[model samples]
Target: MEDALRRQQTERLVDHLERMGPGRVWRPVVDRDGTVLAEGGGPLPDNLEEYISGVDFAGKSVVDLGSNLGFYSFLAARRGARRVLGLDIDADAVLGARMLAALHGMGGVDFEVCDFLKTPPSIKADMVLAIDFIGRAVVAKGRLDQVLATVARLARREIVLTMRAVYPLEGLPPLEPGLRERYAKHISDGKFHAARYAAHALGHAWKGRTIHEGRVDGYVLKSVLVFSSNVAETWEEQGGSS
Candidate 1:
C-alpha cells in the first residue's frame, strides 16, 4: 500500500513538471537493496540497469555522451562517481542537466555543451556512454564506423554503446522518406550506412533484439545494440598514434 502511494505521488509530481516544461523529476523507490532512484518515467528495463551498473564509477570519472535529460548521469553520481560530465550537442539538454544537478544538490556533476564526437581528442574519461547515440547521429550521417572508433578512444577503461543492429548488410530499413528529403538527397541510394557498418563491425554474428516501443507524438520503435569497449580494434590503433 505504501509503495503504491509513493508511486502515485511521484506520478503526480511528474504531471506537475510536465506542465511546467521539459525537465526531469524523480523520486526514490525502495526495494531489497534499499532505496533505488526512480525517475518520473517509471522503471527502466533490467538490461539497462545491468549496463549502467557495470561501469565501476565509484570514486571515478565518467563521460556521458548524448546525455539526454541526464537520467543515467544522475544515477551514476548517486552511485558514487567522483565526477560526471554530461555532454550533449543540444544546449537545452546541457542546461537541463545542470539544473537537475543543482536541484538534487549533487555538486560533483557538470554539463558540457559540445558535439562530443567532434570535441578535442584530449578529453578522456574512465567510462564513456554512447547509449542510443550512434543511430541518431553517426548512422544518420553515414559514419557509423567513425563514431564507434571515437567512442573507444574517449574512454580509458570502457565504452558503453547501444544502438540498433542490422543483419545481412542489405535488408535494413532506409531513412524515412520525409527525413531523407529534408536531410539528404536520396533515400535508397546507400546514403545511410547502418547496414554496412554493422556487417563490418559485428560480422552479422552479434546478438540483437527489440528493446523499446511507444507512441511519442507518433508511434516509433527502437532496438538496442550493445558493443563493448574490448571490441574496438580501430580505437586501439588510434591510441598507438598518440
Candidate 2:
C-alpha cells in the first residue's frame, strides 16, 4: 500500500510535467505495464527492444546520451545491466525520467542533467547509446562530429547510434502531393550513403545495422548503426584513415 501511494504521488509529478513542465515530451515514456505516462507528439520510437535485447548487458555498464525520457535506460536495467546512466540537458526530461524510475521502483538506473555537446561528462561505460534524434540533431547543428567523438570515447565495448534523416536511404511512405514533392527532393534520389556518412562522422564503420522508415512532419525516416567498440578502434587504426 505504501508503494502504491508513492506511485500515485510520482504519477502526479509526471502529470505536472505534461501539464506545465516540459510541455511536449519529445518521446513517450512508457512504464512496465506499457502505459504511456507522458505522451510524445513526435514519431514513435523505433524498434529498440530487439536492439537492446541483443546486447549482453550482464555485468555491463551502459550510458545513454540524449536519453530524453530514459526509456532505454530503464530498459537496460531490465536487461540486467550492472549500471545504467542516462544523460540529457533538459531538466524537465531528467525530472520526468527520475519520477518514472521511482514510480516503477526501477532503482538500477540514474539520470543526470548534462549537455554532452557543450560539456562532455567524465563518465565511461561498457556500452554507449545515442539513439534516434541525437544523430540528426547534432548533424543539423554542425555538431555531429564532436558529439560522435564523445560518444565513441564514452564507450568501452560498443556503441549504438541512430540517425533520423538516413530515411533517404530506403523507401519512403507516400505523403500528400505537395508534401511528397518537397520530400522527393529532400531524399536526394534515395541515396544518402549512410555507411560512409557514419564512417566519417563517427570515424568507425558499423558491424551491423537496421533501418525503420517512419515519416515525421510530413517527411522523414530512421536508420540505426550498431558498432562494436573493439572492431571500431581497430578499423580506425588500420583502414578508416581519411
Candidate 3:
C-alpha cells in the first residue's frame, strides 16, 4: 500500500508541473475551469524563475498593458505582486483575463479595456508593463512624439518596455530609412510619454534627458531605453531605472 501511494503521489506531482509548464511557445494559461489567464506567441525564451527575477516583479503593483491572454499578469500574481491591473484594447482578451482570474480564485488581479497609450495622467503605479505590443506603425506625421510621451506618463516607478528600435545591427540588414524612422518614432513616442509624465508631475521632474541602456541580446543594436521617474541625483539611491 505504501509503495502504491508513493507512486500515486509522484504521478500527481508530475501532473502539476505539466500543468504549470505547458511548454508551448505561446500558449494561453488556463485555470482548472479553462479560463485563459495569459498568452504568449512562442516557446518561452527563458525559464519562469529567470524571467520573473530578471523582470523584478515581486510585491509590486503592476499595470499590464496589452495583456493579451494574461501570461505575465498571472505570473505576477503567483510571484507575490500585491495587485495587477491587466489592460488590453481587445474585449476578448479582457474576458479571458477575467475568466482566468476566476479560475485561479485570484482576487488581487483584475482586467480592463483601456489603451495603455491613452491611460490618464493622474494614475501613478509601481510598474508599467508594455511588452512587444506596439502594434501597427510608429511614425506618420506629428503623432509619434505624442504616443511615446503617453507611455512615459503611465509609469510612476518603472516602465518594462519591449519594442523594436529604429536601427539594425550588423547581422541585420538595414531596413528602409522610412522603417528606421518609424521605429525611431516609437522610441521617441516613449520618450514623449516620459516627458508628459514629467510635465504633469506624474513622475520626477524632467531630469536632464533620456538615456539608452544599450541593446538587449536579441534586440541587437536596437537599444533598450531606460527612462527614469526620479530626479537625476536620486536615481542611484532609488535603485536605477530599467
Residue-pair clashes per candidate, as listed?
1, 0, 14
The best candidate in terms of TM-score: 2
| Selected candidate, larger TM-score, 1 vs 2 | 2
TM-score of 3: 0.55
Candidates arranged by lDDT, highest first: 2, 1, 3
Q: 1-242, model 1: which lDDT tens digit per residue?
A: 96676565545434444554534332222222344333434344343454444455688688887776576787778788888888877765566556555545677888888775566346888777666565554554555656666666676665555554432224444544354444332223443434234434533223222223222223232333333434544422322111
> Which prediction has more favorable lDDT, 1 or 2?
2
lDDT of each model, Cα atoms only?
Answer: 0.53, 0.64, 0.52
> For residues 112-187, could you state the per-residue lDDT of candidate 2 as single tens digits?
9998878898988998888754543344444555667888778887787666535343343433345433233334
Instruction: Give TM-scores for every candidate, taking all chains together and pairing residue i with residue i.
Output: 0.55, 0.72, 0.55
Better of 1 and 3 by lDDT: 1
Candidate 3 structure lDDT: 0.52
Per-residue lDDT over 68-171 for candidate 3, one digit per residue giving the tens place of the 0 to 100 score: 65777777787888889888777665765676566456778999888655554456668776654442243323333454566566666666554333312332
Q: Could you tell me which residue pairs clash in candidate 2?
A: none
In candidate 1, the residue pairs with backbone N, CA or C atoms under 3 Å apart (3 or more residues apart, or in different chains) clash, namely 163-225
Which ten-residue region of model 3 has the weakest summed lDDT? 192-201
Candidate 1 lDDT for residue 32 = 25
